[model samples]
Target: MARTKVALVGIGKIALDQHVPAIAASPDWELAATVSRKGTVAGVSAYTDFASFLAERPDVPVVSLCLPPVPRFDYAEAALKAGRHAMLEKPPGATLAEVHTLQALARDRGLTLYATWHSRMAHAVAPAKAWLADRAIRKVHITWREDVRKWHPGQDWVFEPGGMGVFDPGINALSILTEILPDPVHLTRARLEFPANRQTPIAAQLTFSGNVTADFDWRQEGPQTWDIDVDTDAGRLALRMGGNVLEIDGQPMAGENTIMGEYPALYARMAQLVRAGESEVDLSPMVHVADALTLGERVTTVAFDF
Candidate 1:
């Protein structure tokens, strides 16, 4: 079977760290080209502008966009308009309306548009979901804390408007939560802590329906934390290390203990969606983030640098 050609649009940290390696390992995709002003992969065709890439590389039937939320919609819209299948990174777009528009455009053009939630692809997430399928009413608590300096380094765009600040990482927790829980949940209230100099929050406390609550912080300096605990009639269930580890009643369960499996699974799913001529656009996680921004109480914190 021939691998489908794919053009990766953003060659920044994530594209280089995850997307490139995943594509290289996949049996279903070829990294035919990359479009970025300053980032490029060895031996792959590179284009600084998206328009030229679209014009010259019509053979690339699929485009995977890893650009930041703010500018991602334009590129996605252009790719769908050009009659190519498109895949998007987490949080899909800065606004829900734009993603909806892209969905409609993709449907009209008969192209696949996948708004991916990579965290939902973690190794333990499926098992966790299965465990909770027949369980009764319960509660969920998420603690997602990390040092932004360690993860994002000096990327100033993270604190800018549409960058999503803490919600950028927080949404991963929501993605996994939305996937595992048998019942739906919605944001009820939130408190967002913004750095004095930044346009977005540095930390957030969110309350959701079904007794679900989350504490997200980007200021931790030592060991990072990505954990979610669920209490049910069956027992207590927990997902640690960003849904890669699963636990039941404090005893370790069998599952992958690292975050390495997510991207590869995502690429595989994208290939399946393209082959089936289907589009997968789940915005439930992004809906929670949007609700937080719309209804969260604001608190000013110390100015953040880097």
Candidate 2:
């Protein structure tokens, strides 16, 4: 089988930390080129602009946009219009509307477009999802708190308008929840805490349909925590380590307890979809964020320093 040439755009931390390694390790895909203004990966073709990248890799069939959501839509659209399969990072686009637009373009061109949630590909997620697929659920709770300074460092775009602030990490939780839950969730009420000096929220308390609730904060100072719990008729299901560990009824369930393969799994799935000429366009996760931002009440909070 010929390796699918994948052009990675936006050579940011994530593209270097996760996507580049994943692409290099995958046998079904190869790094054909990269798009970034001021960064480059050794042994990979680097283009300072998207135009040059596209021009050089005219035969490359896949382009992964690992950029921020604010500017992702344009790159993804450009790739789709160029008749290339477009792979989007989590939180698909700046708005829910943009994802739909890219999907339509991909459909019209008979190309595959993947909106991947790296968290959903965590090892424990699929098993937990399968376990809850037939069970009756009572309620769901999520507690995702982390120190943004440690995770994001001096990334100021996180606090800018449309940058998604805490929801950037919070959306990973939403993606895992949406993928595991059997029922649909809708935002009923929310309280977003915004820094006085920033345009985006720093914390959020969201209430969703069917008693689904979440508490997201970017102020934790200790060990970062990512956990979700489900009260079901059969037993209790708890996912810790951001869906990398599972416990049932207060007992640790035995299974693969690793999340390092998330990006690798995402790339493999995207390759499969592209080969099949299908699309993996999931919008339910992003919808929750958009809904919360659109309908939630706002509260001012202290300014955070990185």
Candidate 3:
């Protein structure tokens, strides 16, 4: 079997920390080239721009886009048109419309396009979904507080209009929520808080209902918490540390795995899609974010200093 030759574009923090390592560890993929302005991966051929990289390495079968959402769609569309499988990091594109466009192009070209949700690959997520399969959900509470300065550091793109701000981490919670919920959910109400100097919201609160009520909050302070609790008729279920750990009724749940292996799992899924000749481009999570933006009330804006 031949390994998929993969190139990476926009090699930034995530590309370095997660995507590159995962690609290196995957047997199905070979890191053939990289495109970035300032950084380069260890031994791979590097280019300052995607066009040059694509032109120079016509044999690379796949391209993983690690760019910020603001400038993602065009590059991804180009890769798909070039007959390469394209993998989007998260929040696929700046707008839902662009993602829809990419999906159509990929489908028409018979290419694999994966808009990956890394959080859904967390260790305990599948188990949680199975545990809740026969149960009824009554309510859900998600507290996803992280110090942006610590996690994102000097990345200013996250605060830009298309950067997604709080939704950057909040979407992970929504991903897990969407997977575990027995039925489809619709947003009922939302509140977005934007810094006076920023275009994106720094914090948000949302309510989702599908025979269950969900509350999602993103804060930038305190203990750096990422937790999701579900109140069900059977018992209260809690997922901590981005679904790497699970608890039920204050007792540790069995069969929980905390491998910190999201990127590796993502590669495996992408390989599966390539072999199966299919695309996994679920836009529900992004749609929920757009719905929050479109329908959520903007209460107030405050000053946010990096």
Considering only N, C-alpha and C atoms within 3 Å, which residue pairs clash in candidate 2? Answer: none
Write down the worst ten-residue block by lDDT for model 1: 252-261
Q: Give the TM-score of candidate 3.
A: 0.95
Error of 2 at 179 (Å): 1.3
Per-residue lDDT for 227 in model 3?
Answer: 85
Best model number under lDDT: 1
The C-alpha stretches of model 3 lying farther than 4 A from their native spots are: 211-219, 254-259
- Candidate 3 lDDT, 29-144, residue by residue in tens: 99999988998998889899788777788889899999999799999999988889999999899998999999999999999999999999888888899988889888888888
Taking the tens digit of each residue's C-alpha lDDT, what string does model 2 give over 164-254? 9999999999999999999887999999999999999999999999889999999999888899999999999999989988899988884
How far is each candidate from the true structure, as Cα RMSD in Å? 0.7, 1.1, 1.6
Q: TM-score for each prediction?
A: 0.99, 0.97, 0.95
By TM-score rank, best first, the candidates go 1, 2, 3
Q: Could you give candidate 1's per-residue lDDT for residues 113-191 as a string of tens digits?
A: 9999989988889999999999985888999999999888888988999999999999999999999999898899999
Error of 2 at 16 (Å): 1.1
